[model samples]
Target: MGGFHRFYPNACDLRSLPVQEVDESVSVQEGQRLLQSGLLGGILLRVDDVYQVILSSDLAGEEGNQPLKTKAWRPALFIHARMPVAELLEQWMKTPDAVPVVADEHGVPQGVIDPLTSAGVLHHEFTRIRSYLDSILAQVNECICGIDDRHKVVIWNSKAEELYGYKAEEVLSKRIENFFSNLRITNCMHENKELKGHYHQPTEGTHVLISAAPVTHGSAVIGGISVEKDITEVVQLNQELTRASSQVKLLEQEIKKMSGQECAFRHLTGRSAVMQELIRFGKKVSTTDATVLLRGESGTGKELFARAIHQNSNRYMHPFIVVNCGAIPNNLFESELFGYEGGAFTGADRKGKPGMFELANEGTLFLDEVGEMPVEMQVKLLRVLQEGSFYRVGGSEPVQVNVRVLAATHRDLEAMISRRQFREDLYYRLNVVSLEIAPLRERREDIPELVHLFVQEFCQKYGKSITKIEPAVMTSFLDYSWPGNVRELKNAVERLVVLTEGETITEQSLPENLRRNTYISLVTTPAAQGNLMNVAVEAEKQLILKTLQQVKGNRSEAARVLGIPRSTLYYKLRQLGIPAKG
Candidate 1:
């Protein structure tokens, strides 16, 4: 039995100790190679049975006094094992000076390297190959199911887990055909031939692609692996594109269904359940002249709905005028809608053209940003709805043109009514037929549909053939709090379609603010906040209080730390019922 002194040299003469850098990039194999090279001495670098590296512990010099690296050596070997290396090391710590050996009969190495290196060769594999598998499995958004000749799952990746609504363990030995109502081909179990390639199923929204490879062991055919990839999204997308393409062709056929040569609704595609409800409502309300108050966040296609309503009404052929109440100047409001005579005011037209209200005679007029309409004009609007008569700016003659009113606003007019900014009478009059359109956030479940519509329309409109938003981009799009609402989303899609120059929109193509973190601000800051002042104040109070604990209890410093005025800070504390200092 050779002791440390035997491994070194000269019994009590010190020296003959090998020192090495612990953090060198040398792996276990390299370390073992060095040890087997017969350098100077054999010193195993392992923890228990598992060896990380085996180095030569030969040291230079000899004398009565010992070198620090030689004498101060409390050497131990560490190993990277299948189980926790540190745990294995802790278990076999027999003695302080005991050297861990692989076998008791003789010293021989078991496995002492990376688990992967132990399995495969050092072939040219991409560094991210593992990550790629993880990602493919992760991004396998389309739920997939894998089965064999017996219809038993040989591979149950995470996506299969998500798609089929089955846990991996639960479905591993089970048949995949049990879950799906329509498993396209029954030859999936045919022992004669294997199948390959994708199969598209319309209306069902499921694409079943089967690729089969025979399993052979000892040169005999046992069974086969069948990979089923669900491509419903891809099929739906293709259908949308096909629909958009055949619009003109289908228009002729669809027009024959209705009596009037003039169609009442223009085309905008939406097939999702919510949009279907909207479409149904649109068709139902279009035949009437009732005052429609369209309410939704900005960009939610209120104006589009309004147009559709007018086109479907009794006055389909009449002019449909659109006016943004917020965009028009306060001074020009009366003339913009009611129109002025030759010399009504300073820059009147010689012949005089009618306002949006007159232009929309016998048809429908869409009033956008109705929330921003001045309280002063609310009286004139009420007069029109009540008596159905209005005078031009300079003319005393009441215009007798019959018209329908459809007003829309992104703001909460009810809330505005409570604040005394909006007229309650006008609210009741305009809200004759109220349609509350939900924001994109509340309807996140409809993102796939919305994205499908927007991506298809915008790409075709902008001459960009981008088919889909990348998985990451779609994730970010769903996560982002679109304050500007659907309008913002459309603009983002347009921007991505134009700028990305690819078949898909990526997260990078979106605005900097949008491609960020998702957790909707639990607390709102004063800046970047909307009319929800009370919510913002409460949120700011919560954020300040939570951050205050980091510095213990220092109000003056806390205010400075919070980036708010000390006086303002005190006021906040008083408002929140939180005591200051004492």
Candidate 2:
């Protein structure tokens, strides 16, 4: 049999690797001492100018027997000292039990690069890579979390601690659901799939957009990783909007009539011509059983409009049920919309409960966030609308129901139809009477009234006696873009009413973003002296500063939420004389 040597020149250099060398004349006792001292992993020897490597095993029981010699000590496999570390590793892997000796061109022993040394090197490299990954995760602005196949928390970054209010030390090795029961990491791990852009509320008062995927090892899933973007502010704003919209609805219902024309739509408040026209159209549609689609952005009071339509309809006295299509899980859509029979599936109600269609029988069914409805459910809904009847889950008999379907959404159904996400048949069915409610920005004329309404509502609720809002504050309200629409405005008013100590709400009580955004109006102020450029620069600086503060000095997150590139944010920071640290 012939022995062969392998080498890879550029793979890795073995020259820097530590090796063990000793003269062949060393006694067995000395070799044992060297091995026990841990100064050398393996010993290299030169016998008759030929190299031999001796591991600790070779010296076993030889201490009291005789002096180390060619016949007594095992001759380990040998390689050239100049061989690349790749070849060394390959040799070690192929012959794991054999220690290797590195020798010169003249066959003189240089040193031994044994299995123990290679393992130590690999462990060191792994630690370095792990440390690098940890540092990278720390800098990321979004929350990053990971769980192993055992369903234990394995990785929790700094942002995760900030968002979820749990430290890595406290959560590591614990079941993920113990802290964030709403997190879908376990689901991803079990299903071995990915879920992105999912709206999640990990804990009360904390809302996030989560994207999670299974971490796989070839054909097997080893773990799961999730990234969550905090959207608590946006969600809170929308919630505030919903509350304010509800308050407005309540107030309108209290009034006997609003100029007689808005008697039916008193719940839908707006003095603008567009709003009045929309109200008139809503009232006209409310008299019939036509399927009406309320189109508007979130927090624009789409549900309120639907209720007004339902209340004014002939079946106003019947049951009016509201279903948020976006909030329902896809798997439960069928059972939720069309009631399931007893023992329909596992964990089902023994006695089938009525679905939205059955509950809203003979009345109006308001489907909010209809665009978020699954494509499969859209066909079923279309059939119900067209046939005026549908079968329940796990039932053979057809159930009849008279439901005036009123659909509302903040998404563009036309675009979704083009993308084939939404059905055109359903769109046509629901679009019999389409009303596009104007956003707060477009109907800025109604700000004062809406502000007055929200202030009174919040003031009465919070037990505050705030009666007046400063003109400047109101101007800021009008000038500032209400991205959350009426909801954002309502939230701002509520915030001011709660925070303000006096009877009057002032600019100082305004939220930081609201005040900073109104800087464009500063040019009109007496102190500005018409310095538009200065006013603009100061506004930009304040906006950047506020954004940075909101993100807790994370510039990357600030840039992302502000809809600007990270480099652009940095440039603006420099141009505006702000620190670049965060």
Candidate 3:
């Protein structure tokens, strides 16, 4: 027994304990006498193949004459010999006064557990479990804080100390509200609810993703636990990134301004001397609020220049509304310029609509082909321009606006005014700062640049790869007078790029008019120094000779090709002193 006690301080099982085995024929009085002698721990009575435990304390004053089987032994809990120490201790602890009987696999009683040893084992196991829980709380990465029902801090893990700068010794057992006045852990416990992935700012310049839950034992609130992840560095980084982005944008805007690629006018391009001068002058004009009148031939990019002016102006950020006076019907002119109210007329907008002036408020209003406006409407337009206000079609209330007017036209407004077809006062009012845009022929140097620009533009659009234009084609382009101006030239280039089969544009791919013009330019270049009549005769003679040569000296075919009567061709042959035979 001394050897067993040294090897296993807390007895692992009852196998080595003292026991008294007796037959059921033994009288209960004899069983009690033997147990009271204190030589054994318990008495096991055997009847046939079964055994039952009878403790001496259970039969204290009963000296019955009946057999031990008839003794008054209360029901006992039987534990297996192989039962773990924790389980044995738990069973003994539940009914502390009842000594449990230990048995083997075959229902044979071994012995009874010692009450003193079982109590010691229970305390040892509880200490081991507590140490394990403390180790887990100390090593986890997330901040852990726990509070009891009294709102006192019960658990503060190592991570909590690192994040909140409060040691466990300093915070434990203290009211949590004293440390974090706005903590949601208290709210979680009060509401008896759980919070998952909640963002919180516990202190200034600190951010965290926190989760909290109330600890409950059988529907009764006992405490609460909260876990948090510190995200202060991440939040600071994001704020710094936003400021850096804003600074980069500001730098980019400043660079564009220094390089003359200002936001709105960057797309307008021209390098010719006349165009450069006009652009410079227009840029100066764009700084003021005075009315601007753009004058040019039809298709001379009048509207484009007007847009560039507006874009360069102070009102570039606002809208630039264009109203084509020639395109609007005379009857709808007033309503279109000055919008109508709701139910003003049949088919009008039900909620009313703003007109060009209202839409162009704080911006530029470009009245294209302004000469085409009816004389009556001209008076109303002049009045609005003078007063900066106008009444809607159906409403009597005057609508005031601050719009800069830009008028464009290809007609001679002075001539129309002289004929009384246009209002003279209106013409003068619109011509405050007249800007004459030169036709494409007058600024012929810009044609090549415009041509290449259009070529690159159309190549990408039509999926073509025409890289170069034949020298002859470029020469013809230079000589041809573009009556339709830049707009016409752009269309012609688009057509050529689309129709040309190969990677180069040649004279054959040009339109019929362009080809004919090229031939006339070829013949007229040498005689350009001669008198007007001499140059004209030389051009005519070269045309006739080239046609006759094409048909191998057939005069009738030559005359037919020239679109002239055969007799007139012969008379011109004698008149120009050409050989009649060939």
Candidate 4:
């Protein structure tokens, strides 16, 4: 016991006692007697020079009989007295029920650490550390899966159980590949590589994004850890957004259709049979990809019809480009139509520029006054129409384009073809569908409606109001031949609205060529002076003739304009010896 005190001075000093030893041959009865006398809480049993701990509880008997040998005593944990006191205390704290035997360098028992007293401080610190770690792991939202080097699952967090539908007890220590074949953890361990944003579909309708990393110690990969985020809701939301976008596009198309029907064709208005038929045909051609040739006078609204057709087509979302063939210079026609390369000419742009055809790709191209294109350029235009490809100026490569061509011309293409002024091949190509707008003179019945429409339009533009037109002014409009067609009529009405001061437009406010008396006399020949009755009768005859002509020989319209009954007009026509029908 003195040698034991020399070996572990501090442990002996703390208890203020010397070491106690028991022989291996001592019976459990003797050991209980020592404990009852309060001489020892535990004792060391010597085996040669080594020592083992024997707790006082080991002396208990099953039925009042003691064990014969120490072989029946449970194994004891030993510590060297030369070790630090703090380490010795920690060992006792981990196993509070087991006694620790402190031995010397020669393995002789030096002291014993009473489990009840040494474990109190260490137990409190160990419990606090364990609680902190468990709380942190429990609060994690991402599923955590960890695997050892042997490919067995070691850590399965609560989030993992919720996400993968498996409990920790069921999967721990099991082979990970048996449950999930393509887990990133297995791949990361085998490849020793970090994977990020890896997508995996474990089951139907279950999508997860996984980020995994190799667990390494001292530059050696020993295990793998992976974090999984459930992305099923995100995937579902993206699919729904795609479907909603498609529905919105369809609704926009329907709205454009209704708008086209209501106002896109407002420029092509008339009640004449020929004009009605032209409008119906134009509407039909608007839905097709066919080339359209609009033939009419300059102011006949051919360009307006072209725009309406484009607005009603499927390519309405793309650009609608207009190129005036007659307006572009003959020298720059080819370059303007087909684009140019960098430094193609002395004054060309350094970066080059896309021409009308390229600009109008996937869209409509309106070539107004197409008959004005030179004969040489007509061949190039025909090639683009036939092949859907063309070469830029000074460029070796041919550019491809998808474009719909809509051509308008006031010139007589057939007559020009005869004189070789226009290419017959190009003419045949352009005239896939032809529409001819009737001159305004030929549709005289539409004049009043056009005048009213123009009045409303110009009034809004100039911020003025003129709602009424005198009967004499309207009669002059019906009788005059509008050589410039609807455009000319529009200009005349706009002038009246802007320049007239009165709320009503009268004959005094009319232009020189559109006066009532002048138009009536122009349609009838002058007669010599005569008696009052004769002069009055002559004037009435001239007025009736002019009104009949103005209404395109419609007797009902004629009587309406003249403010006479149809029956009275018929009787007067018979008395004047004039035919009622033209």
Best-matching candidate per lDDT = 3
- Mind sharing the TM-score for model 2? 0.47
Worst 10 residues of 4 by lDDT: 1-10
User: All models: lDDT?
Assistant: 0.62, 0.78, 0.81, 0.78
Tens-digit lDDT track of model 4 for 1-582: 123322222343233123467766777776677666766656666676555566656666523335424533433457775565555655666866555666677976666666455455446645775676577668988888889999899889998898879999999999898788757787887898998988988778889998998898758888999988899899999999999999998987788876765455666767678878887888788889999999999798889889988887878888899999999999999999999999999999999999999999999999999999999999999999999999999999999999999999999999999999999999999999999888888887677767877888998999887766765667678667888888899999988898888677767878998875454554454562555565446656766776676466889866665555789889989988789776
Error of 3 at 398 (Å): 1.3
TM-score of 4: 0.50
**TM-score of each candidate?**
0.44, 0.47, 0.50, 0.50
Global lDDT of model 4: 0.78
Q: Estimate the lDDT of model 2.
A: 0.78
> In candidate 3, which residue pairs get closer than 3 Å at backbone N, Cα or C atoms, i.e. clash?
none
Please list the Cα RMSD from the true structure of every candidate, rounded to 1 decimal place: 27.7, 21.6, 16.7, 19.8
Is candidate 1 or 4 superior in lDDT?
A: 4
Report the C-alpha lDDT of model 2 over 363-474, residue by residue, as the tens digit.
9899999999999999999999999999999999999999899999989889999999999999999999899989988987677668878888988999998755655576
Query: What ranges in model 4 sit over 4 Å off?
Result: 1-252, 257-263, 520-582
Error of 1 at 22 (Å): 99
